[model samples]
Target: MLGVVQTADGLPIHHEVFAGNVAETTTLIPTLTKILKRYPIERVVVVADRGLLSLDNLESLQKMTVGNRPLEFILAVPARRYGEFDTLLEEHHAQHCVGATHEVVGELVWQGQRLIVAHDPEAAATQSESRDKRIEALEQDAERWAGKLVEQETGRSYRGRKLSDAGVTARFYKAVTDAHLGHILKVALNSKDFEYDLDEKALKRARMIDGKLLLVTNMPDYSPEEIVSRYKSLADIERGFRVLKSEIEIDPMFHRLPNRIRAYAMICFLALVLYRVLRMRLKAKNSPYSPNRMLEVVRRIQHHQVTLHRKQSAKGLTTLTPEQKDLFDTVNLPKPSKIAL
Candidate 1:
């Protein structure tokens, strides 16, 4: 697994390479240990998404000491598992923000820990609409399966591989799982028919907290808004990851040994570093070009070579466009030269 740490402005601080099978939650502590030993950061609060939050990881962060004090953290709560926070959220919302149309921020005690909830009415509407659509589609699929099974029982026949009960159960459950409705819908499979049980309570709870984002923080000094904002900044690091995957294409490895993989990861990490730095520079300059666009502009300035007498070569460079020149200046790089240095 490749984990990268970045600053608030999204420039990469460092990256860690681990065995690909390592659990994401388990990597945070080790990665932070290395970063503390290397960087000169005096105060630190780890802001991570829900995927990296585990009870063990949270406990480790709570016990970890930076210098003379315990580590601070703001982590996202997996609110989709609404059983853990449904009542707390209802109480918090009822007592604090009722009928809030925009974002409503509130806090409550969850098993003696501070649970920060941010409710976006707009997001709630979107989530509810999306879930309703998916559930509707799932119900239609279930009906279609029921019709097919009935046809089979009624002595109707067709081509293509017959749909077995096993296959239908697998397919229906997969569709339900892909839609993230497993908690609300249970596949009731029998040898003869495909049916499902809907957990009304789970469905109600999901709708109750559709757009609610739960965050937990141990930083006593930080406010709820601060915790939420810091956690949102993690999106920048996620963007960096997408850049590594799509633009850099770092996968499809042929290496069998660990050390070679590490070297390749380091090289890709350096390239990611450069890409982020360029992005920062371009943003600061208010340039209209993205890093990818800047690269495209740079690529446009091709070089031409001509062989002269005495086997000497003369080179010529295409004239730089105005946008291309501004891109070069923004990136703090010299223009390409026709003459060999």
Candidate 2:
């Protein structure tokens, strides 16, 4: 359950996964080693969400650092551990600052490089709104369930299932069968109870950090602006994921063997690399064609008729249009021969 993202160019530098278990750290290095063995990646960098905020993981990364230099990392600090980040956020908010990005510099115990912090106001606002919607939806589900619970206790019935007017049976079935629904109700009710203070605090914090986003990176040598920009390059991986999920068919695993799964995935990754190279080339040419459409053109060009005639001398001619010629030139393919008479 971990995804490793590595830069494709030169230096296979990549970041390993966070299995969420300290014991799992041992497995991470080995897993990455296996990938490197087959792929021969150099210059590996690791990036992760806050779920990877583990002292042990940092130590592991430090140990794996090669030749007085360890791997590069872009890791998010947990909100609780974000001491400098919190201060920076407050400073930004206090000034009524809008359309501004903040940067903070620091270091970790295991990492030799200083950590750079970046915050994006607009992205943060969008993310916060999305989170709020999810929380609200969860609360609504819980509230609806709680009302049913009351109905069960009041003697109501559904589809011949005896329930109270408050739907006690309905609530009981829901609580028993759908643990997630039950948990949401528990959380919603507890928000009212004020035992954990989680609900109130969550709502408060969401409002407080309305337009703030935080990202911390160990690439201290680079400017905060550059770090933030590079970190956002992870968006490229989303395109790769779409290709894997939609075109490469990583899911619906037909084989049972683990090796087969790994092999299939690796092959898909290779295909994606080639696809990306072609995509970058097409983009450079400013070709007004989607990758799929470009691929269709390639397929068509491959089958393009090339007639050959044998007489005193052998000769061949190919039928290709000006547009096809332009595409071939852009892709660095040889121009087709003229059609044979």
Candidate 3:
């Protein structure tokens, strides 16, 4: 599913469900086209993650027009291509950016579009620490595997048949591959002898791009900071998806037909809409309770039947707590009646 969430309000304005096999990158243009046709939007600024911002999708978005006005976008560039922004990173440190946790460097024209580069010191530090830990762990794993290989080579312990040099090398390769440690480690095999070493060159290159991010956009008037902010708002869309799949329990769908699946998705979407409305109301009123807490309070206001004088009385509701009352008032929802048929 592709969701287009509004940055200003964090509401899902549009969504599309593709086949299970369809790639997320391929859905970007089609989803945007559907949204444009459905809404009377004169100008648009699309914000998306790196996975949805391929070169083809970027070109397509550039050429899109709404009533002769071109569409705008703030798309994140993949961090793997960090070398292209070396000059920008150097220039960013010299600039004075007050009250900002990140530094936005000037824009450059790339592939006929403006590219904005930003650096976050905190993010860089966190990423560097994480990478260092992974490298250390991989080194330890390499040492353990080397010891096992030695045991196999020597006549210390044997389980049935002994492993060949190729077998030992293959086993080590599989282990590192499973752990995703192949990038930082190199393995060598020489006829009954094997060795594993850290790939220092790759680790050094990764460190350079630790805290840097690149953003591509077609908006000429938007500053680098604004572009970065807009792109960061893409997280709102991701949060909406989480709400659908987790909070709303939209997954593990048992529907067998395509139409049924689509209907279920729509139901989840509507539930998200209602949830956001209540959330916004509570937030506007400065309420300190979360949606789940409010729901729990509401759930506590249950009803039960009573019998009186050989006659069955209507259901009677429990009294609401002060917190529940405050929540209802903040959300502008009327309290339930004490009794109901």
Best by lDDT: 1
For model 1, what is the C-alpha lDDT against the true structure? Answer: 0.82
Model 1 has a clash total of 0
Per-residue lDDT over 1-341 for candidate 3, one digit per residue giving the tens place of the 0 to 100 score: 43444535876676566788888777767776777788887888878777766767877887888788898888888857545555544445446322347653556666778888777767777887987887677667667767766776576765676655677678877777876667777777554566777887677656656676778888888788888888787777778778888889987889888888888888888888888888888889888887878888888888888777879576778888887888889999998878756
Candidate 3 TM-score, C-alpha based: 0.85
Q: When superposed on Cα atoms, how far off is each prediction in RMSD?
A: 3.0, 7.1, 3.6
Q: Best candidate per TM-score, number?
A: 1
Better of 1 and 2 by TM-score: 1
Q: C-alpha displacement of 148 in model 1, angstroms?
A: 6.6
The order by descending TM-score is 1, 3, 2
lDDT of each: 0.82, 0.55, 0.74
| Model 1 lDDT at residue 338 | 62
Clashing pairs in 3: none
lDDT tens digits by residue: candidate 1, 1-341: 88888877888878878887888877788888998999887888888888867677777888888888788888888876536677677667676555778898777777567888888888888988999999999999888887887798788876887776778888999999998899888997664556688899888777778778888887788788877888888888889999989888888777889889888888988999899889988888888889888887788888889887888887788888888877788878897766672
What is the Å distance of residue 269 in model 3 from its true position? 1.3
